[model samples]
Structures are given as C-alpha cells and as structure tokens.
Target chain A: MKETLLPSSIKNKEKRSAVHAKLKQQKKVEKKRNQKVREAAEKKALELGEDPPPKKTPRTIENTRELDETVCKPDDEELFAGNDADEFSSILKQECIPKILITTSRFHSSRGPDFIEDLRSIIPNAHYYKRGTYDLKKIVEYAKKKDFTSVIVVHTNRREPDALLIIGIPNGPTAHFKLSKLVLRKDIKNHGNPTSHQPELVLNNFTTRLGHRVGRLIQSLFPQDPHFNGRRVVTFHNQRDFVFFRHHRYIFETKESKTPEGKDKKENKAARPGKVVARLQECGPRFTLKLTSLQNGTFDTQGGEYEWVHKPEMDTSRRRFFL
Target chain B: MPRTTTVESPGCPPLRALTFDSLGLVKVIEAHDGQDGGAVKMVERWGDPDSSKCVLAASILDRESDPLVSVARKCGSIEVISAINGDLRAQIPNHGDEDDAITGLHLFSKQQSESSSRACKLFTCTTKGHARMESIELGGTVAEFVRDPSPTVWDVCGSGNILCSKIDGNENYALFGGKGVEVNLWDLQKCVKIWTAKCPPKNTLGIFTPTWFTSATFLSKDDHRKFVAGTNSHQVRLYDISAQRRPVISVDFRETPIKAVCEDIDGNTIYIGNGSGDLASIDMRTGKLLGCFIGKCSGGIKSIARHPQLPVIASCGLDSYLRIWDIQSRQLLSAVFLKQHLTSVVFDSHFRKEVPVPEVTNTVEEAEVIETPAKRKKGFKDEHTSKKKKSKRSSKKRLSDDED
Candidate 1:
C-alpha cells in the first residue's frame, strides 16, 4: 500500500508540488553560489583597494531600449566645460618668442609706402616682404624657408588697410582680423633711453578669444635673451578692447668701491640687488590696436566672403600678466 | 590566392566641393574598367547638407546577393542605400532623439534555417543608452523591430561599443562597453543577458577609476569566446568569457588614445591606430609591436577595414585620404585624396571585376604572392628571424632582377 501511495504521489498535483520544491531548492543553491561569487569579488576588490563591485541588475529588454536623458545630459555638459577649461589652461603655460614676417597688399603699397616704414618702426625685427601677386602657396613656402614663427598679411581695400591675416608656422591655426582706425606714432615721445639693465614685460587685459595666438605673436617679437645683461621688456595691455603696446628698459649700476674691504662688502651684497641699483626707462612707441573680428582657418581677405564683428571682452582679472 | 591588378583610370572626376563642411558627406567610389584605363568614379554620395550633422557609424550589409550600406547619422536617422548605386532603399527616421547620437551600427544574419525564413538583422546603439534590433527582409524592408530590455549604464559617446558576435557557433550576442567598468553581453535571439565581464579599474593617483574602451573587436571568427579592446587610456585589453572578472591580458600601446582597431584574418595580429595618425601591427601572443606602417596617415585614423580574402587593408581618417596597404610588406599600395574627412570604409566582397581591356602591352604585374607550404612552415619557426632574412633576401633579389 505504501508503494502504491508512493507511485500515486506522482499524480499531477503532487508532481507539481514536488517540482516546485525542487525548483526552490535549486534556487537556494544558486543563491548560495552567487553569494560566494559576490564575496570573492568583494574580497578581490578590497585587495586592489577599489570600490566594491556594482550591483548586478537583471538584463531586461525594456531597460536596454529605455532612453535615459538625465544620465547623458550631465556628461555632455561636463565634457564641454572640461574642453574649454583645458584649452585655456594649456594656452597659459606656453612661453616662446615669435619670429614674425610682415607683408602688405599691393593696394596698400600703391596708397603709400610710409605705412611699411611705420610698421617697421613698431616691429623692428619683423622681415618685410614685397607683395607682388596674391599667391598663398608661394608665401607659405617662403615663410617656411625663412623659419618665421608667424606671418601678418595686411590687406587694403580702396586705399584703406582693412584686415590682417595672421598665419602660424608649420600648420598652426590661422586667424583673420579686421583692422580699423589706424594711427601711426609720428612724434617720438621722449620717455627716456635704455641703459644696461635687464627689463621685464607685462601684457595685461588682452581678451582670450585668440589670446594664445596673439600672445605668441607678441612674445616672438622680443629677443630671446636671459635679461641678465640689460634687455628691453615690452608690455601689451588691452583696455576697452584695444591693445596698448608699451616698452621699458632697465639699467643696472655698480656701486663705487671705497677700499678692498668695501669692494668685498659690495660683492657680498650683489646677490640681493635692490631697486636703488636699477633704473627703468620707458621707451616710446606706444600704440593701441582695435581687433574688429577674428575667424579660424586661413582667409585670403581679397577673395571669399568677409564677415567681421567686434571681438567681445573676456575676463582678464585672472590673467594679469603674460610674459 | 590569385593576383589581381588594379587598373588606373584615365581621368578622375572633379571634386565638386572642397569645404571642410563637406566632411559630413559619405561617398563610395567605384572603379570601373575602361578602354584606355580603368576609371575610378564616385558611385554614390549621401548627406548633402551643409550643416554639421555627420555620420557616426556605418555598416555594409553583405549577407545577401546584393549588399546594402546602412549609415547612422548624428541627427538620429538610419539610411539604407544600395551598394551598387547610391539610392535610398529604406530610411528609419528618429531611431533615437534629436540630441541622442547613434554610436554603433551592426548588420548580421539570423541563425534560423533557410526553410524557416532567413532575414538580416540590424542592431543599433545610441549614446542615450538605447539598443534596438530590427529585422529586414532581403528586399531592404523592415519586418520587425525589438528593443533590448536592459540598457548599459556606461556612456557610449566616442567610445566604440555595441559589437555583435556569434556565440556557441549559432547564437548571436551583442557586447556593449561604456564609461562604466562592466561589459555586458546580450543574447540577441532571446534578448536576455548572457554574461558580464568587469574591466579592471585604471590606477590613477592611487585611486581606481573606470577606463573606457574606445574600440573593440572579437579576436577572430574561430575564437569567438575571446575579444580585444583598445581603451581611451591607450591600453589594449583582451577579455575571455570563461575567465574571471578582470581582463586576461592588458598592454599599453601609446600615450595618445587609440581610435581604431582591427584584427588580421588569422587573428594572431592586431592593427591599432591612435589619435596621432600612427598605425601599428601588434602580435597577440607576446603583446609585442610587430611594426608600424609609416608615412600614410597625417591625422587621426578613424577606421580600419581588412579585405575579406586579400592581404590588403584600407584605412581612412581625419586626413581625408583613403589608403590601401599591403599587410606583409607594410607598403602603401595606393592612396586617393577624398577631399573630406572619412570616418569609415568597407570593401564590397561581391565586387565583380570587368574583363581586362588590352590597352598597354606592358602591364604592371600585381604583387599578390601567396605563401607556399614550405614558406609557411619556415615562418612558423622563429618568425622574427625568418622575416628579417626574407626581407634582406628580397631586397638583394630585387636589385639583381632590376639589373637583369
């Protein structure tokens, strides 16, 4: 009768209950196995000094197709902010002197040759190139061979210098800017003459639109000297969106020796030279430039569409001096 | 292997546009045999907009007799065009939201029997964490669309995730990795999670942070259980399904991030291209750099595709040039200035060659030599040493042959 009952236990209801119990037991075993795996993973993560493993969410078809806007929106915002900050930070750390080449359009030369002379006085080290025809390829090749750091091409329309095309050397970013209200410093304002002391430069208030390229251009105009021996320091300050260029020179003077003991005392004091021993002179050629517009990629200024706008001011309180 | 000559075209078509905005357009140039010379002509160009919406991902559907090319746009549209001539066959607009960009597109055939009704499946994933699988019949019409239930937690922007692999020789699985450390594998047939592999955290400043994978591919057709990935931190990692949570093998390749990666036909070598326009072939077993293909790329390489049956590789990138190179010789065979930045390229496996027109009697011999049994055996024993000797011998033979 027990055997009959045991066989009858395989009846549909009884069989279903037995199968359910078996499944429950199987699930329990699986839970234990997963617990073991989780513990092991946690221990491994601890050993590596990492955060615990993320919770394993069961994969579902609905979850995979669900569009989560909140998660991606923050990431996009963060990426944009990060890129802008990185570009600014990288531009600030650059320090190199630029070798500039200045060229004028044929229209500018036809208008007057005095503009070239005036530009030469402002940037003494810039090499002047005569404009014959507008061949960008030939000019770029020539600039490369001359090892110029930057090329400043002035374009004139109807006898008025209208725009400036600045191209960096060896495939750097090119920028175009419209020039307005040109003024040449005719009178040599007698601030003072430079002596034999080293000088320092301060470029203040320049906006950060193409600030790095502009800063590089200004720095390259100066000589690459240690300034231990007296060197001229130029400062470019942009106020009211106009770049004001200033130059200063300092001369170091040695004290007269009274006796051998006095000379020894002077030598000991040489390491901490004060302002009493150095004299600063402001050399005049100060000028201001109003950058009307800026655009990326090379522009001919003669051909193609020209769209110029006044450059907006950037916060310059953080960047007081660019040396 | 048979040596096939690529005939040169007499006169190339003028590139109508040179603006950088044209980078958004995708063109496929077809070479047709001509009487005097073979003319390579643009068969189709998709996306004629001057706006900034670019192609994010594209896949060539080569399963059927007539292949189709599906391109995913940044504006959340998928366009299917005929491979023969650029004609819109089907278009799926608004696959994702306007702001949501599709990161990956893959085409694979279902494992169902021919009698059971075979159809091609198109799988797409977006940066918004959406994965959708659509079934398309042989005539380029959508039959059904199924979306996966479980989405990945990782951000898929810029990182190349959403890859399809054949699992257990029959079942198809899609693998996705993102900014998160975990890589999820999903069974496409059941639309359920199969397994997950957790990538090891990057050790930065004594802190463990997740490293995102930029590109990934299965090791080979035979070794479907294992896959390789290139990370944003310039690491090449290998993961095995049967292995533990961590990647089985990892190696640092370069300082710049890797943008594109592809495996050789035999699966023993991996070709990787980084952001600095550098392409290198790496040995899988020893994790050693075999050689770098020099002087071809001038910008970041966006994609690399290997020929289905030939020892040729086609690479296109931000440099706006499509270059074909010989894998063994590491020599640039041909280059075409496409005048626009190319994000991806795929060869038509069913491309038929026209009858060779007898124009010039002295035809340039195509250099497509297959390795013989004896040479292959010699190659197996100390490959590096044999390769050096072979190169030296080839140079000397070429010199003598030229003199003769």
Candidate 2:
C-alpha cells in the first residue's frame, strides 16, 4: 500500500492503453453504434407515449469452466435412436384382424317411407340391393359356399381405450373409426348374400353402446324432444362433424384430391390411401378379429377371406383350398 | 352411469348446473346425436309402473346393503329382482373363474365349461296376477309357472276369479281392499270372512286395469284374521275376517262412491305417490298424514315403497326415473333413469352379488351385453344334416319342456 501503484487509476489507464493499441478501432465504433440504437429506441417509445428503460437481469453463477459433450451425448442420442427404432418397428409390424360388428334394430321411424334416407345418415357405406344388394348377398353366399370359417359383422360402438375395435391383430393393424353417441336405426339383415355359415364373432356388448347410440338416434329423430328419462344431452363443439355418407365404396383413389386445387399446390398426392388410408383406431368394446393375409384395397365384404388365414395350431399361415 | 343409482352412485351425470324450468312434478331429459341428432323423452304415466330399465319398475336403486338387486314396490307391495341376470351374462363372475394358466404341466388342457340350466330358475316370478291358492315355486324362472286357464287364477283376474285367486302362499286366506282404506281378509276355502279393523288405501292399478289396491298386508298377529277392510266412502263396505259377515270399519273418499282400498307394510304405514310427483305417507292407525314429499318427475307415478334399511321412499314413474326420497329429511336421496319403460314394481331384499351389470341406460347396450345365454335358435343347421337330426331330437324336446 505504501509503495502504492503511484495512483492505481493512472496505472490502470496505462494498462488499458497498451491493450487497446493492439486492437482495431472497430470496437469503439461498435459501441457508438449500440448507443445510437438505444437512443433511437428510447426516442420512439417517448414519441409513442410510453416509458422505456434498461431491464435488470439476475446474475447466474457459472459452475464449470467448459462443457463436456461426451457427458450428455451418448444417453440422448440413444434415446432419440430408440424412438426412431420403435417408430419403425411399430409401423412395419403393424397388422390387424377382421372387425366385429354389432348391428342394431333397423325399424324405420313412424315418420314413413322417407326414413330410408335417414338410414344413410347412420350407415356410412350402405349397400342398396336393387342392383347392389343381390350381388352383395351373393358374395356372402359365395363365402359360405366355399365353407369359410365364419362371418363377421363390421360396425362400431363406444367403449374407452378400445374406443375403436380391432386396434390391431397379434401383429396386424385394424381400421380406424370416429364414434358418436347417437344410435342408428339400421336394418342390415338382408344386406349380405344368403350364407348359412355362422359368424366368426358374435358381439354381446351391444346394449351399452347401442343403447347410447339408439338413444342419440331417437333423439335425432325428434331434436326438440326429451329422452326416455326426460333429459336431453346437449353439448356443442366447434370441430364436431358427421361422416359424409359414403354411398359408394368405389371412389378408392380419386377422393383424396377433394380440396380446391390451390389450397395445397405442393402437397404430394401420391401417398394417399386411395383405398389404403392410414386409419386411426376408435371405439372397440364389441370387436372380434381374426388374422388373414389379403393385402390392402380389397376386403371380404362378408368378412370371409378364407384363402388368407393363420393356423395357430399348425404355426403357419396356410392358404385356403378352394375346390 | 345412468344404469342404476344409489347414495354412493347417482345414476346420471349432474345436469347442467343452470337448472331449467320444469313442468308440473315430472321433468324430462333429452339428448341428440353428437351435434346434429334428435332427442327422446321419457313420459310419466299415472298409476301404472314405468317400465324403463324395468328391472323392477320394481324399485329404483336404494341404500340397501344388497348389490345389483333392487326391491321396488307394486303400489304398497314389495318384490325383489337382480340388476343383472347373470344367467344372461357371458362373463358371469359367479359362474366361477377360467384358470387358463395350466402351462407346461397340463399342455393339452381345454377350457372347462358348465351349464347354467339350474341358475336360470332364480330370478323370476311364476305367477303374474291373482291366483287360486295352489302351491307354486315363488322366485324362479318365469317359464315354469303355468298360467291357469281358470278365470280366478292369477293374471286372469279380469277374465274371472279376483275373489278366490288373490292371496299369498297357498294358504286358504285371501287379501282384498276398499275405498281410500286398507286390505281385508277373506277365506279361500270359505270364500268370505270377517276382519277386526280397517286400514287405508294407497294406489291404483294402471297396467292390470283394475283397482289394484295399495298398502295391503296380512299381519302375523292372526293374518287378515285380525284386520278388517277400510272404507273412506259411503259406497265402501267392510268385512271382519276373524268373524263371519261382520263389518269392522266402512269408509269413503268421494261423495259419489269409493270402491277399494289397501295398506303398505303391515297397515301401520302407507305411501301414495301421485302423477305430479307428490308422495304422501300416512299413519295407518289414525290415517294421519305423517309426511309428504313433493318433487318434479317426468313420468307418471306408478309404484312406491319404503327403503328396507334407510329412511327413503322409492318411487317409480313413467318418466323412467326410479326415485328415492328421504321421507324424514324431506330430501331426494337419488334417481335412476332407465332406458326402458317400467311396468311393475316389487321389492325383494335378497342379497345380490356385486357385479358390473351392463348399461341399463343404453337400450342397445343392455340387449347387447345380455347376448350371453340368449335363447337357442328354433331353426335348423345346413351342414352335417345327420347331426342336425340328432340336434333336432334334443332341441324339440326342449321347446316343449319350456325350460328356457
């Protein structure tokens, strides 16, 4: 202290000058530029009738002098790698068994003949028989004629977790569905060709979801009417939408280009399901399923694809022998 | 959630907190499909039972200790029924477990199966209406009870013998009622009797289309032998069952004429629920108004009964709500809205095991869930026609036996 740097301030100034002499003058010019920017911002705020001030930031202590990428890299990369591997496995191994359907009563409303049109509201792909029906039934006959293992009623119901049935087979994936509480009054008894074979699955969980659905359906018939309990379920949502009646199941591919041409000009239209949509799983309490080897696009209408089957007993996928 | 309701489990999700204006005593609830569907409302019929989820029309869910079994009132009469007919369920818990883990020890083992032929005889009443005093199995399959063609044989009342047929057990005693009063005793063998005193009436018959008396009971104190018919009107008549042709009490309700009456429990108490959801409890001794409960219901009040263990009065209405009221506290204990209409109410307190009976609120779901053990087909098989012949031999005998 006695030998005191002849005025520590003078000594510090000399040190700064020596360091500054080697550096370019741009550092000083940059500082002036930053000051100008700050002034301009403050001036703008004042003009706008606002208050502007420098913000205070809390200081944080730095623990380590340097980062070690090796410490965090391996586990994180492995986690990401694992995720990618799972996604690949799930996608490739995914397969689904046939679906189980629970058909409700088909009695038309007392309102009369026009009620058939109402049927379309509930049955997405209703097959009419004059031209469509006879053939459909014939197909069922063909299945039974071939002595297929069993028949299946394909439909939907509401039960959580399995909101949609047939999520997937032991390794296969199933179709997707969106379910509503409304009950549908559909008579599907005469649709399939006369087949004598019993169905692969008989769904008994019909009453719960069907009652809910029918309750909804009955309510729909008389919108303003109260339910059997004198209570009405009324909840509105922005995205609530009903399925578009798919009167024809033939528009396998061309349907994807439905949006206006310009909405997404760059969209790659090639990947659509045109008969092979990547469906999401939905309601599934009454679902029954079986494994078959038929590829996408064409499905057995009667749910009888005998040629494609898995014989767990034989531990093999054996093709059905057609006479 | 709307299947069956009790104190611990209220059937319906709470309605919108902003309650709406209700009409009369009954209020209706309606809901449409998602955002764009229709609605269905329950209608209340006065006097007759509401058959929605008609398990009991019998009685609404109560605070009784039993599980899945409800005791509903037929006017003042009590009868019991299981909430889930396990014989009708595929995954019946009481049907026992399917231990599929035999593993390496028993490699070729098959799932063992059992027949429910005997269990089918548990949950039904053989006789439907007035009956001639004949010995019959009381609570069993509905199929075993034969509907007697004789006019006075139960359910055939309108067809014939209301006097000789209406009685409990195969005893030679008969129970009848009067106008605004209670039940009377008559002898099945002797045809008529004399009673001691008269009690008050409680309900009307809606489905049977008769003056189905209410609050009628035979006290063990000597049976209807000690009690007499009550008449609240001038046109009313009374009979002394213990004696012959003696009138104990004659009463009337209207100046014109009151026909019959009945009592609930043992004539000590009686309950009467009206169309407007009004339930009145009366003290049988003096016919005094013990208490009255007023609540809004959408269906007609068909039947009502007191909780066997709780201070609740259960009522069934055409509105599909099996409602329980805390008569002492004058509060609504609970309401179970059914998807189906109710036609009758009987109370039975037999303990039913705990089981997840499927949805009663869903008409479809209920039917679907009960697909288990459904009736066998009456038709034939296409394959192995020879086997069909064998099946025919057995199945034909079954239909005639009517064991199903």
Candidate 3:
C-alpha cells in the first residue's frame, strides 16, 4: 500500500487569491509610476520656463499581447555559496534582491529543452521562462521583476551555448560578490579596517562560451540531429509540470516566508533562516550525485507559473550525524 | 584471444551497405520501410578487441511496415550518420562497460588549424552505400537536417568530409575518372575549386565506371603529409601535401594497371587489385609487383579494404559479390552477394548481423507525392522549365515564397 498525500484546498485557494490581488496591485503601481514619469518631465519643463508640448494619445490595435514583463525581480534567497545563515536573514528583512537572467544563443539546425527538466535539485524555488513562444524583449521584461539569487550560464559546444541555467532566489540588493567575490569565507574585524578571512576564489583563466556562432555551416560536424523535441516529450513526461522536490537528511537548505494578511502567524516564520537559495530553473547539469528522498507534486498552469506565496519551508543543516 | 573476426551469413538481410575504418567494421547499415520514405533502424557493431559492440539508436516510422528503396549512407571511424534514421541499429548487440560503447565513429577528422572556431569532424563510408559521422568534442547532440530548398546536397569526399554533392540534384561532379585516374584535390568547403591530376585510370578491360584508388596519409618520420593515389593506369602517384607537389613516384606495375591499392602487413606491402581482376602483392618502399597470386575474375575489381589486424584484403566489383581474399594463399575464404548492384564497397569491422532485406512495396502516400502516369505525360512540358529551376544550387528560396 502507498501513501496518498492530499494538499489543503483552502490553503491553495487562499494563496491563489493573494497572488491575483498582488498582480492587480502591481498593475496599479505601474500606472502610478507612469504618471510620475509624466509629472517629472513637466516639472523639468517648468523649471526651464518653457511650455511643454501636448502629449499624444498612443494608438493601438485591439488584438494585442497582454502579459507583464519586468527585468529584475530577485527571488527570496540569493546564496552564492555563502555559509552565513544570520547575514542572509538580516538581508531578507531589508527586502532588496534582484532577479537573475540567463540567456544564450540558439543554433540554426536544432531545438531542445534540457535545463528546464533538472533544476529542482539545486535551487529550492525557481521557474523558467516558458511562455509557449520565444520573445527576447518579453523574456528580459520578466527577468527584471523576477527575484533571483544568481545566474549561471553554460554551453554544450565550443563557439555558442547549447543551454542556459538561471537560479532566482530573494537575498539581493547587494551580495558577498561585492564583499569579496569569494565562496564561504568571511571578513575579520580589527581596531581599524578589517581584513577578509576568505580570499576570493581563483577565477583567472576561466572562459565562458556565451555568444558564438553555432550551426552546420561553421562546424565540420554541422549536420547534427535535434537535442529534444515533441517525440521526446511524449516518451518521457508524465505531465507538462513534472515538478519534484526532495529533502535530503544530510544536507538542509530551505527558504522561509510568512502568509500575507497576518494569518496563521508564527514567531520565526517570516525569517529565512538556514534556507538555501530557491531556484526557478530546473533541469541542469549535476555537480555531484547524492542520494536524496524526493517527492513529486502536481502543478497546473491554470494559475500563474510564479506562485510567491507557495514558498517552500525553511531548510536547515543536519543537527546530528551518525557516521 | 581472437580479438577480431568477420562472419559471413548467407541468409542475413542481403547486406545493403558496408563501410570500414582503421579499427575494422565502421558500420553495416541496413534500411527498411516502404511507407513514408521507408522507416530505418541502425545498429553499431564493433571490431575493437577490448570493447564490445554498442547499440546506437533507432529512428523509424513505417506506415505499411515494408522495407524502403535504396537510401545513401555514410560511415566513419568514430560515428555513423545517415540521411534517414533507419532500422540498421538493431544489428549492433550491446556489451561492455558503460564508457566502452563503440569507438568514437568520427576519429578520422583531425584539426588542421585553430583558425576556425568549430571542430572539424570526419565520417566513414561502408560498402552498403551508407555514410556515418560522430561528434568529437561537442559530443552531446549530433543530427543532420535535410532542407527542402537545398534538396540534393548529399555528398562524401575522400577526406571523410560529408557535403552536398549535386547542387540541384544533377551530376555536378567533383570526383570522377576511369579507375580513379585523376585524384582531384579539392578544398570542397572553402574554395570549392576542384584540382584534378592525372594519376591512374581503371584498366579493368573496359567494364564499369572508373573509381579512384587514392588514400591520403601523413609521413610521421618527416612530419609531412602525403597521399598515395592508385590508378588502374598500372601506376601509383604519390603527392606531397606541403606544396600540393607533383607526383613523387608514378610506380608502373608489370603486366596490369592498378585497380585497387590498400595497406597490407604493417603498411609496408601494398595490396594491388589489377586491371584483369588480379590481386597482386607489391612492396611499398619500391613499388614492385612481388607476386600476382590470383589470376582473374569475372567482374572488374573496384574496391579493396585491408583487415584491421589480419593480413586480409576484402575486395568487391561489378559482379554484385563481395569476396574476402587472403594475401597468403590466393583462395576465396568467404563470399556474399549484395542486395542491389553496388557503386562501391568496403569491409566494416562493426558489421554484426546479416539482416534480411524486407520486401518494399509502394505506399499510398508515395503515390500521392509523385504525379500519376496520366498527369506525368503533361508534366514534361512544365517540367522542362522546372528542371532548369530545380537544378540551380544557389536557389534556396522556397517554392511557395519564390512564386511571387
């Protein structure tokens, strides 16, 4: 006999309502921001003592695209290999993280989706730009508002990229990248200036293949078959949303957040303590293969792809080790 | 341990295509399917001693479940690729450790200079009329696309470089000769200017198309590159790669023109297929016909491939038969007939099963794609003008867009 886990429908509905309301509020904010821009232009004109030109009404077609696009909304926890749990919590309280964007070139002869399938293991809360169609301008817009921890770019071939990996968590505004560009090292305080304890990792001689020409005309072995396509989807996928989450007993990393409107409040719930970076992108390269207990969840596109309130529980390191 | 072995099964799907590389069997590709250009399956058999044969993948879609017509294929040392993903992959039985799949199929393609950003890949051709190539460094995904605009761009050169042969599907040739007389030196991808030279002409007593017998190689002792172009002209022309120099030695043989020239017994002795279908042994250092063991055959000898480890020479000709001839004794050890009349032949070390060629029948879809007999008569008037348009290689615009 297998255990059948059922989610609380009331909680889900509440989360959905909050998200929808937030979206509407964001739209109103955008309209106000546009008026501010208009006012700012008029104030400058008044300072110069010159009459401003008449504002023209924008023309539009009825059948136009309807979607929000913003470039940098950082996710909840931005971890660039930082070990300080306290520092991350304090950063979250200040509320300033930027979303990450990872874009690469597409080859002339092939099409496939790989990185989108394997990202759950790395980042806790992340989503990809799956808008059915590809639009760079629109993608960039989403990246602006997306909360991201870090952006990692990789390539399968030499000249150009075969894929892109982006992880967007929340801890932004400023990161340890500005502190020292090091991994898991700290700063030493002294009477005057404090010397850093962890030196920045050796990053010299590191080359990234981002924007390069890729296709059969350039490569001697140009006539490549596609990586993945419709047939592949039919063979492998259980659903459009093949989302899985795993909790490893040995390693703990989680992002914590509170329910909005002051409901079901708990004392340390809002604090993202000991939580690892939540990633929006899944299906990527693996650094090391570790055993973990994974759980699967059903996610429908009926709601928006980004559900902020559906934030995962906080993750912490193991308290005790037997071996 | 018997590291390498070649089996001859008479009842196997009459071998359609065969290609051989240095390590032995490149690929024995088989194509089957009648509906929708006939579905295809490919299996990779290996000849390397340590590693076992590894199964590649299968890509086939048959509506009627019948075999297909003749399909061209390419084979190489590292990888094997074809225009149609057929059922030829079933022949390669799986074995060995995970990493020890098949040897890299495109091993022949070497980097000339770092000037270009992309890595140059090489492929091998089997006697089964199949061409195969494998990705070298950028290895994850490798697939070729057949453009409707540039339809007949399929072609393979002496260098294992796969390119478009006929621009608009005519006989736009870059390599042709009587027993491969003139070895055409072509920078096919760059200049596209074909440099032809008079080497050896096929002397198979005036029968069949002439094939080239040149195998371009490098001289390790001097770090120099050269080519040994064999001709049915009873001569072998050696060209130095440094200067695209003239022939170093045009070795004329005794009594027969060179039809087939291949490496034998450590690259010292060259196996020569003479004009009279005679197999001769010659010393590489001094081009001397040491022995003319086998006297004659019914068909003109066109192709010859040496065994990877054994002193064996596999030969084929217009007779539609492949014979594995021994160098020591002029005896026919094993022989097999091909499914169709072959254009060329090579022994692939990766050949596993002699899969039976399934019977191919016309499908309703193929009938619809092609014009009916009554309409085909009227089509000629319009076809004459269309033929000229179809023949031009530079015309890449789709017919739909070009109608404007």
lDDT of 1 by residue, A1-323 (tens): 53234433566987768766776787899999999999999999999999999988975432342221212133344223322332122323334445678887765754335555555544545778887785765786788787776677777888766666677664543555555655433445556554433345577744332343355445544455436555566677765445666666666776543445866767756655433466766665455555543322343332111112221222223222211
Q: Summarize candidate 3's per-residue lDDT along A112-187 as a digit string, tens digits.
A: 2333323322232334444435454344445545644333332234432233322222211110000111111012
What tens-digit string does per-residue lDDT give for candidate 3 at B244-298?
5456666766444454556553545666664435566666566676776442243
Using TM-score as the measure, the top candidate is 1
lDDT of all predictions:
0.57, 0.30, 0.33
Query: Model 2 chain A — which ten-residue stretch has the worst lDDT?
Result: A240-249
All candidates' TM-scores?
Answer: 0.46, 0.29, 0.27
What is the iRMS for every candidate structure? Answer: 22.0, 32.0, 35.0
Over A1-323, each residue of candidate 2 has an lDDT whose tens digit, in order, gives 52333333445777757555534365688889988988999999889989986754643222211221112233444323322322123322323112222212122223222232333222222322222233423434543344321222233222211122121212221222333333222332222221222111111211221122212222222123222232112221111112211111111223455556764634646555333443221111111122222211123222111111222332211221100
Interface DockQ per candidate: 0.01, 0.01, 0.00
Q: In model 1 chain B, where is the ten-residue run with the lowest total lDDT?
A: B368-377
What's the TM-score of candidate 3 when only chain A is evaluated? Answer: 0.21
Candidate closest to the true structure, highest lDDT: 1
Segments of candidate 2 deviating more than 4 angstroms: A1-323, B1-130, B136-172, B177-184, B188-267, B352-404
Give the per-residue lDDT of model 2 (tens digit) for B172-225: 455544222234455545545434233334337433212323223333323445
lDDT score for residue B34 of model 2 = 29
